[model samples]
Target chain A: MKGQRFLGLGYLGPYIIGLLVFTAIPFFGSLYLSFTKYDLMSSPDWTGLANYERLFTRDRTFFKSLNVTLLYVLLTVPLKLAFALFIATVLNYRLQFIGLFRTAFYVPSILGGSIAIAVLWRYMFATEGLVNMALATIGLGPIDWFGDPTNALLTITLLRCWQFGSAMVIFLAALQSIDKSLYEAAAIDGAGKVRIFFFITLPLLTPVIFFNLIMQMVQAFQEFNGPYIITQGGPLKATYLLPLYIYEEAFKKFNMGYASAIAWVLFTIITVLTLIAFWSSKKWVYYAGDKRS
Target chain B: MTDITTSNDLTMDETARAKRRAGLRLFSTAIRYALLFLVGFVMLYPLIWLVGASFKTNSEIFSGAGFLPQNPTLDGYIKGWQTSTPYTFGRFFWNSFLIILPKVIGTAISCTMAAYAFARFDFPLKKVLFGSVIAILLLPNVVTRIPQYILFRDLGWLDSFLPLWVPSALAGDAFFVFMLVQFLRSLPSDMEEAARVDGANSLQTLVYIVVPMLAPALISVCLFQFMWTMNDFLGPLIYLSSVDKYPVSLALKLSIDTTEAFEWNRILAMSVLAISPALIVFFAAQRYFIEGISSGGIKG
Candidate 1:
């Protein structure tokens, strides 16, 4: 019995070590570091609340990045979810060659958030690039995609939206798992297609929607690659997201203390947002077989 | 004669209704295919363009927006393979595989072991530990990057793959562990109980019974690790500094940075090569890929 107990612990040993070294210690370490002034070369000096103070009081870029990130999350998450849901609905049909379309949509996601894709995006949205070329043929736009500050953020947002396949696949799975009999019953009652979808499908899908929303929101806040490679947070810091700001502060400027403070702020925002999502989900997210509140 | 005319009129009404219904069905089908094609085109255009651009000369790439190269050439592939870096693209590919293979195997082993413990055993602190796993999954990795960097730097493990894959060996990915735990929960504990009754130890039972039953989930874990590691940028960017040690992702970035004229064709070709392994792996085991995603590996 003692040996069995030890064996269980043995199995968990690696994970325990990882938690300590990678997660727990660093988590607290960063929290502590957020309160101190330290560059990589020097030992950290205690400066209680100074980093936080500086961030709140004097950091214009900090607030700008925060606003930009918030705007990004606002724009990308809903749009991506809608796009995913729409595609997944189309895919939910028992159509021939559906796998090909699913794979096609998913291919970009499989190459998700890579430097290569970001680079490809940069060129694609360039002034004389493919997007503009297509626009010209349509007699519509040679719009400056990454040039104008107004449009630069949108460019990056579109890139995030483009990789909606992961969320779509999750939604597809959820849609597939939904009780088909419910749909049959609705149809038998003479419920129109849209009515059944809005009343039945949408309600049942709220749980997955909630999940995707939270995940995508968190991802959008920490988004780096598209802004980093495609826009370089350029055209007047339009896409200077919080994560990039933290990276620049920590590594580029070697202000680890301030960077840690920024990171903690981000951490807090994510946690709060996630909590808010969970709290709000109680109203709409329906889990089958669970008692209604 | 009047009664026969009335019957003909009723038949005409029935035919009209049927024709309208058919038209609606055809219209809906057309709309569905149209939407699928439009979205698929948007999803795939960049990749298709990348391949086409790979064969075009720098000047040719600028001349037209069309995917077809006016003058198709192998110069991009030939030149991109010989990057200006001391190491070639082939070296970077090897480096990627080196990181990917070990990370995948390590993740499978460590995650399965930890998940098995969480699933089958009644251990102390299990609840807290499992909760921590979920919490960690929610925690953005960017928050941990600086402190991890400092820690690894202090340990003199900078500029190495150790900082990258060693953590996987320790089941650092809480997502995979959680996923496997979920998988294990869905499985009946009968085989494991049988093995225990037959005097098998925990490890032996895991190897003999649990592992074989857990093959699909385990394969999903491995596939995800493979694809994610291959496409990972930030990890390699943070940990590695040496050009020789650079993986395909970093190496591709390095080529862009170092090249003065910025040969789009060559860079695109190298980009194609950089992503080929992941694309090939995904296409080959797409079942596992989709299974992994649907089974709760939510992040792309």
Candidate 2:
């Protein structure tokens, strides 16, 4: 027992110290500071619910940013996951260069979140950029891409959807795990390809699909870079995502308390959404080895 | 078609069904190629535009509105490099390397240490602490930024890269720790048991036996940290004030924010430059990345 104690301490000592100083402390500190107004240099003053109240009633842009973020989440998550699953299905085929194709698809996702890509997004969608050029080629006269509020949000969402690699890879892994014999049986019973996909692949893929959905929704709510760089919260605050709104409020406006309130709201939103997703997934998600099934 | 072969002898209806299946197969094959081509084009188009724009003149970039340049030139690269914001583009490149190098090393060492401990040991309150690590993963960075800022400010660590470096050094990357822990758990425990019987301590078992075996996991963690830290805009943007202290990511934003007319060509040029190293690293160590993604996905 004495030797076990010594071994435990020796093994976990660094981790314990790190968690205490960095994670546990900061976590509680943030919670406490949410009730106060602190702007870095000045000492925090107790504001209690003032920050939260202001966020709900006084700030109009807060609501706008919320709408923008929710819209982004709505637009990006379904399209991205659908596209990823589509690509994963394609790659699951017996292709000669499957590995190469998989790698090629993944590179964009890594590059997708980058400053360069965000910059590239802005450039590509700009009035005189390649998108307009392509429209010109089809004799469909150039349309205002980023200049219009509707197109601006759509453009950013499309940029995010393009980086569907992580979800695709997940879908790939899930697709590969599906037993081939089920498909064979379905085929023997004269099931069409489309029917087999709907019955077999789709049912089997529900868990991964749910996982990707929850993750993407959480991430989409926190979308900052694309809007920050491309639209700067926009032609009319159209592309102003919640995270960007919090950042501008905290740093640009120096309202840390208000920003913290927004942050808390974001946390609540994510928790509620995730809970809802999990609850709904019970209808669709299937575990392979479950006796109940 | 293949499945039909596995079935018993075909009757008249089955023969008719087989003919229909062949026709459907040919039709589906054409649709498959069409879908593949459409998806491929959608994925590849933006990157091609960026690459093409990088070689065009300011007028060509501005007026062409096309993927291919009317008259391509390397002039954008020259101007982007020579006239980028904050400093010459060279300094931004150096800043990225300086920051990413330390971060990669620090995260690797600390995360692997903690991962090894979690993998090898069964201590008191193990599940509780691991749960905290998982909880922390779900708490978005914004929720913690304010208090972290206060802590840094009180310590007078603001405006320095110390905050970024210190957290990594102290092993605050719960995701990496959890990932490496899972990978280490997947490894056979018998070798360590053998080492334990041979009179080696936990530390010696970890260092002499486990560390050498966990190289692939360690390398993947390092690559992920390197790319994430290198491309990080928010952390550096919030912390560092001075232009010289700005990493390439922050500087890239500054290049646009400071510009009056939205210089498209220069931004693309700088974007290409900033993205090259991570791209190169990704291509070089891609195998490890694929493993990391798969393992991390299931665990995450």
> What interface root-mean-square deviation (Å) does model 1 yield?
2.0
Tens-digit per-residue lDDT, B1-300, candidate 2:
767765645566688888998898777766666677677776877777778878877777767645788787777787778764547888878888888888888888888777876777777787887787777666677788877876787799988888788888777777788889889988998998999899997778888989889999899899889888977888898888888888889888887776546566777888888888888999998988888887777545
Docking class of 1: medium
lDDT for every model?
Answer: 0.88, 0.81
Candidate 1 chain A worst ten-residue window by lDDT = A284-293
Report the C-alpha lDDT of model 1 over A1-293, residue by residue, as the tens digit: 76665677789999999999999999999999999999988899999999999999999999999999888889999999999999999889767798888888898888977778887887888898888887888898689888798699998988888999999999999888889999999988999999999999999888789878877887888898789888889879999999999999988888888999999999999999999988988888887787552
Give TM per candidate. Answer: 0.95, 0.92
Q: Model 2: residues >4 Å from true position, as ranges?
A: A5-10, A291-293, B1-30, B65-72, B84-86, B259-263
Maximum-TM-score candidate: 1
* Candidate number achieving the greatest lDDT relative to the actual structure: 1
- In model 1, the clashing pairs are none
- What are the fnat scores of the candidates, in the order listed? 0.66, 0.51
